[model samples]
Target chain A: MIETSHLSFTIGDSQILRDVSLSILPGVVTGLIGPNGAGKSTLLHCLAGLTEPSSGHVRIDGQDPFTARDDDRARMVAFLQQSPTTVSRLRVEELVAFGRWPHHRGRPGPEDAEQVAKALDAFDLEELAGRPIETLSGGQKQRAFVAMTYAQDTPWILLDEPLNALDPRHARNLMARLATLANEEGRSIAVVLHDINAAARWADQIVAMKDGQVLAHGASRDVLTSDTLYACFDTPFDTVPHAGRKLVVAT
Target chain B: MRPWVGIGLVLIVMILASLAVGAASISDGDGGWLIWVSRFPRTAAALLAGAGLALAGVVIQNVVQNRLVEPTLTGTPEAAMLGLLGVTLIAPGLAVAGKMLIAAGCALLGMVGFLALARRISPRDPMLLPIVGLIYGGILGAIATYVAWQTDLMQFLGIWQLGEFSAVMQGRYEWLWAVAALAFGLYLIADRITILGLGETQARSLGLGYEQTRAIGLVIVSVLTAIVLVTVGAFPFVGLVAPNLASRWQGDNLRANLPIIALGGAMLVLGADIIGRLIVYPYEIPAATLVAILGAGVFLWLLHAAPRRA
Candidate 1:
């Protein structure tokens, strides 16, 4: 379990995250949704140990992520940021091999190779395995990076806006992959999403934020309510039942 | 791939020619001994320094995540040059190895200062970082130039600044082997360096120690540059051009580019050294100055070929 208690962060004088306490359960997909400047990314960074919180502590499997050694923390958690920048000329296979760095440091044995191959196969990147990342299209690159995180094989995966440049089909495909990972493999996935409908469709739990505070967080059914959506987004969003599933639409 | 292979072949040919065709002439066994014992050290120094500089360029580009960044462009070499100046003034009678160690130390310190200043001013704006480094280099270079002018040692320092392998003999060039060793060590850590280029957070997520790896990389680069400066004088752009060329064809994988970068750097220096010898026949121009000109031309071509965002 990953937990944050009374987390507050500031950049200069402006408070980016304020008095936020959250618990992310394992074996579930948690969706963090917020409008622009809502500190959704900031909170994700805090959770991933990319950002140090000014007030509170974030613990991943009971160890402070910020202070934890990279090898120790990497075994428990993996983070993928928005538009994950990479060295352009690295081949897909070599890029995937980077996931094993924490496990073996730099020396890759036969087992590491097996895991790398498995990651490529899992993400359907086997065909493009030797291709340089710079040559791949936007969607392909995103898939490759996600595959890298998957290869990390951590219990918890945190992704910040992984679907930004993806088309609808690719986006849906990525979400399905994450959902499958969570349900079948018993891994925890926390994703920061700008699209509300995807969150409503795929998220097991949703945390709604507004102005750096958690406005609502619960099971999908509770957090995807019309009142909560409206309050968090400051706009009217109608939550309608479509085939026994929640559909949140802004009007 | 063929072009790179061809370049490699051509470089080997040039290296042989460099060894064969010096002012001493090949017919005389005495001249042959001069070539083997005296000039060969310079030749090896050229190969080592060239390859080392290019490799350094590649690492710097990756570390800063900018295509245009190089030792010369980013003022790293100038900082190294200033270090050389400080060491020369403070301890005029110091051994070459001692001078190199001092230069490396100062260059590492300068690099740290640059990083600190960069962090303080702006984290993401790399354009500012190089500009700041350049300004720093200019100030340092100016001080060095003024010092050289004031002291009767101006001519001696000027000779060092304009890189020449004319005086490199066997005993004088053993220190370069240490640089070659440093380059190999860098190759071992190249994967981590490339991973760090993705960003600190990404590196941390991958279980790589970002600060530690970066510090080690900068230190290695400084030491490599310092060794070259002390050994072969200050040849600019072998680092920048070699890495740039390697990236064009070698896929920017540090491991993949290791040998390629080394060979490319060797080729550039050897080829330049050969050409410098052939031109003006008996009166030899400094190999470093000529290569810098060639490197500048290639650098411009590379600038044009680089991505717009880079």
Candidate 2:
């Protein structure tokens, strides 16, 4: 389980997150939805130990994730930043192999290579393994990066704006993969998604935020209501039932 | 186009040409012993220094994650030049090895200082770091030029400025071999250095000590720059050109490209040296001048040929 206790953050003169507290359970897909500049990414960064909080603390499985060793933290939580800085000139396989760095350091044995191969297969990247990352299309590159994060094999995966450059097909495929990982593999995933319906249809839990604070958070059944959506984004939303589930439609 | 194969072919051709041409051309050997003692070492010096400079440039580019970075442009070569100047002034009779040692030490210090300044300003901006380095290089070059002019050491400094393999003979060229060995050490640690190119956060998350690897890379660059300074003075952008060429084929995996880049560097220097010798005959232009002209032309071509991201 991942827990954040009164975690607050400020940069320069602006407060990005304020005394926010939340707990995420295992085997659930937690969707973080918020308006622009709502501190969703910032909070994600803090949880992944990419940035230090101003006060309070974040813990993953009872250990301060921020201060934990790289290998330990990597094993517990895998973080995929929005628009990850790609290392150009590297092959897709080589980039994926880096996900195993925390485990193998520089020397890779047969087992590590096997895991890399599995990740490539899992993300449908085997065909593009030898191709340089720079040669891939935007969607392909995003898949390569996702494959890398998946190759890390952490129990809790955190992604920020993962669907930005992906097309509908790729986006839906990725969400399905995440859903499968959550249900079959019994792992937790926290994703900051822009598509409300995608979240409503796939996410087991939803946490809404506006202006650096949580507006509403609960099971998808309660959190995906039109009132909560409007309050979170300051825009009107209509709800419709589809396949016996709530789908939020923007007005 | 496989850059490694191209570089190897060029290096081989240059090696053959270097052995064949000189003041005492292989066709008419004034003394067999003279060729062995003098010309052979000079050729070796050019080859070693060229390879070292190229490898150093590759490492620096990877560390700073910028293509524009080079030892001469990054202030290290100028700092080394100053070290040579200081040694010449303080101990006029100092041997070439002593001068190179002083140059290496000073270059290391200069590189460290530059990195510290870069970190303070903007660690993430690749362009900013190289600009600061270029400015620093200019200041050091100015100081060296002024001092050389005042002390009537202008001719000596000028010869150093326009790199020539003529100064290198068997006995005087051992320093370059040491530099080549240092370059090999860099190759051994190339993986660690490449990891650093991924930015600090990513590198650290991968269990690498970013600061330490960066420092080690800088130190290696300093030593390479210093050796090149003492061996052939300053040679425009062989360092810049070779690595980019290597990257075109090898894709930034330093370990895979090390030999290719080294050979490419050797080919560039030797070919320039040979062309200089052939064009002017008895009145040879400096090898450094030829390198500048050739390197710039090739660099322009690379600008067109370079892949978008590599």
Candidate 3:
């Protein structure tokens, strides 16, 4: 389990995350949703140990991510930042192979190669493996980056807006892959999403935020109410049932 | 593979031509000693300096995330020159190794300073970076020029300004071998350096020590630039041209491309030295002047090609 206790992050006099405490369970997909400037990304960065909280702490399986060595922390949790940037001339397969760097630390064993092949196959990127990332389209590049994150093979995968620049079809495919990884493989996933409908449809648990504070946190159906959505986004949201899943639409 | 073989053949031809085509005839009496003392050292210096500068260029480009900025553009060589000027004035009797260390330290600081300034600028217009770097280098160069003038070291400054292999003798150019060792060190960490091109956040997420790795890269760049500067003066654009050309041909996989880049650099410098020897026919133009002329053309072509590539 990854848990944060009374975590607060500040830059100079500006507070980005204030008194936020959250627990992300294993074997589930937790979607963090909020309006712009709602501190969702900051909280995600804090949880991923990319940033340290000004007060309190974050723990992954009872160990503080901040105090852990980089390789050790990487083994425990893999983070994909929003708008992930890569070297232009790097090939898709090579980029994904970098995900295994924490495990091999530059010396790739057969197992590392196997995991890279698996990641490429998982993301349907085998065809593009030899292509340089700069030559790929937006959706393909996004898939390549996600495949890289998957190849990290950590117990906890934290993605900050992995769907950026992706079309609806590609976004849905990515979400389905993440959901399968969570449900079948028992890996924990915490994704910060701008699209409310994606979170409503794919998330097993939902954490809603507004003004640097948690507005709601519970099972998807419980926390994704019209009232909580409206409060978090400062806009009216209507939740309707579709095929036994919640479909959220802004009104 | 065929292309590599072709390049190797070309390099061999150039090396042989460079060794045999200097002012003194290698086939004449006492010519073997002349070849050993002058021709061979000059050839080796060209190759080593070219390889080192090109390697340094690739590392600096990755570190700063800009292909246009090389050691020459980033004020690295000028900073080293400034350090050398200080050492020459403060302690004229200082050993070459001591002078090199100080220059390398100064080059590192200068490169770091350039990067710090680069961070504040948006990378939208890529050409702006090199222009800014050129101006920054100009300012530094001006300062060095002022210091050299005040100290009556104008002739020394002039020699450094235009890199020439003409003066390279057996003992004078051996320091460049340190760059060869450092280039081997660079090869070992080639992957880490490539990861650094991914920017800090991605590098950090991949369990790479971003700051430490970047510092190591800068140090390598500094040492490489210092060695070249102290030994055979500054060769502009070899670093810039070789890596850019190699990346264009082979992509940015440093592990696979570094050797090619090194070889390409050596070839370009060796070629320039040969052309410099033959162009004026006994009144050789400096290798730096010819490289500048060739490099400027390629650099402009790169600028024109960049938009399409992007």
Candidate 4:
């Protein structure tokens, strides 16, 4: 479980996160959604231990991420930040292998190789394994990076906008992958997402934020309502039943 | 069959040429004295400086996450020159090692200053950094030049500013062996250095101590720059051109590619030094001049090739 208690973060005079307390349950997919400047990214950074909050405390699996050594924190939590560096000249497989760094550090054994190969196969990146990341298209590149995050083999996986460059099909495919990882593997997953319908379809829980505060947080069915969406995004939102599920659309 | 094997052969030939071809040619029965005293030291200095500068280039480029920026462009060499000038004026009786420490310190400060300035620029655009480096380096160089002029130490400045090995001898150039030691130390942590290219958040996520690794790289670059400047003077683009060529041929697997980059740098400098010696036939053009011309060409090609290569 990743828990933040009464968290407030400020950069100089501008506050990025307010007195926000949130609980992210283990073995579930939690989708974080809001408009721009919603503090979703900041909160993710805090959870990842890449940022220290000005006030309040963050505990990941009962230990403070801030105080844990970088390697130990990485062993426990794998975070993919928004727009992570698109390194050129590195083949897809080698890039994914970097996820194993926290495990082997530099000396890679047979087990590390097995994990890397498993990660590549899991993400269906076996075909592009030898290809350089720069040569891949947007969706393929996004898949490669997601595969790297998967390769981290951490119990908690936090991704900030993993679907930015992906097309609709790829985005749905990625969400399906995350949902499977959370449901079947029992790993906790938190993702910052822009697509409301994807969150509605795939996420078990949802957190809606606006102006640096959590406006709504609960199970998807409870929190992903038209009123909550409208309140969070400052726009008119309509939720209509489509087939067996509800679709969130801005009017 | 491997590229490095071919490069090794080429390097050997270059070393032989460097030792054999000089202003004072060795006669049949010279008994290795000239080779040990002058030619050997000069050849070794060239190789060490080239390798050192190349690794420095790799570190700076990875740290900044831009291929175009190198130590010379980062105000390091200019700062070292300024430090050396200060030492010359204030404490002429100080030891060479003392002067080097001061210069290395100044180079680190200069690099930190540039890094702070770099924080302001949008890092997404890689081209902007080289321009910023050039301007920042130019301002530093101008200040150094003005200081040298005021102090009438322009001749002293030229010896350190324009890198050449004609004056190299055994006892004088032995300190350059530090480059070899530094390069070996860099090899051990090359993976961490490579991780730096991933940018801060990703690198840290990968369990790298991002600030610590970056600090280590900057210190190494500063020390290497100061060592080269104080020992055999400054060479412009050994760091830039060597690492780019290695990356182009071998890719960004820096742990495995470190030797290739170092050797690539050594070859370029050794080759340039030979050409400099042979082109003027004993009169000798500065290896610095030749390398600047060649390095600038490679740099321009890199700028033109960045978008196309991707």
Query: Which candidate ranks first by TM-score, i.e. highest?
Result: 4
Model 3's chain B yields a TM-score of 0.98
lDDT of 1 by residue, B4-107 (tens): 77876777777678788777777786876777797678778888878888877777777776666666656565667677777777888888778888888877
| Model 1 segments more than 4 A misplaced | B1-11, B117-136, B151-153
**Which regions of candidate 4 deviate over 4 angstroms?**
A86-88, B28-31, B308-310
Mark the 10 consecutive residues where model 3 chain B has the least summed lDDT: B301-310
Q: What does candidate 4's lDDT look like per residue over B162-278, in tens digits?
A: 999899998998888999999999999988887898889999988899999999999999999999999999999888899988888777787878998999888888888889999
| Model 3: colliding residue pairs | none
Cα lDDT of model 3 by residue, B72-164, tens digit: 999999999899999999998999999999999999888888888899877766777778889888999999999999989988888878898
| RMSD (CA, Å), each prediction | 2.4, 3.4, 1.5, 1.4
- The CAPRI quality class of candidate 3 comes to medium
Model 2 stretches with alpha carbons more than 4 Å out: B1-10, B26-31, B82-136, B143-160, B306-310
Question: All models, DockQ values?
Answer: 0.67, 0.39, 0.62, 0.67
Q: Which stretches of candidate 3 lie over 4 Å from their true place?
A: B307-310
**How much lDDT does each candidate structure score?**
0.82, 0.81, 0.89, 0.89
Residue B143 of candidate 2: its Cα lDDT? 96
- Candidate 3 lDDT by residue in tens digits, A9-48: 8888888889998899888999999999999999998898
Clashing residue pairs for model 4: none
lDDT digits (tens) for residues A9-101 of candidate 1 = 899988989899989889999999988988999999899887899899998888898788878888888899888876447889888888887
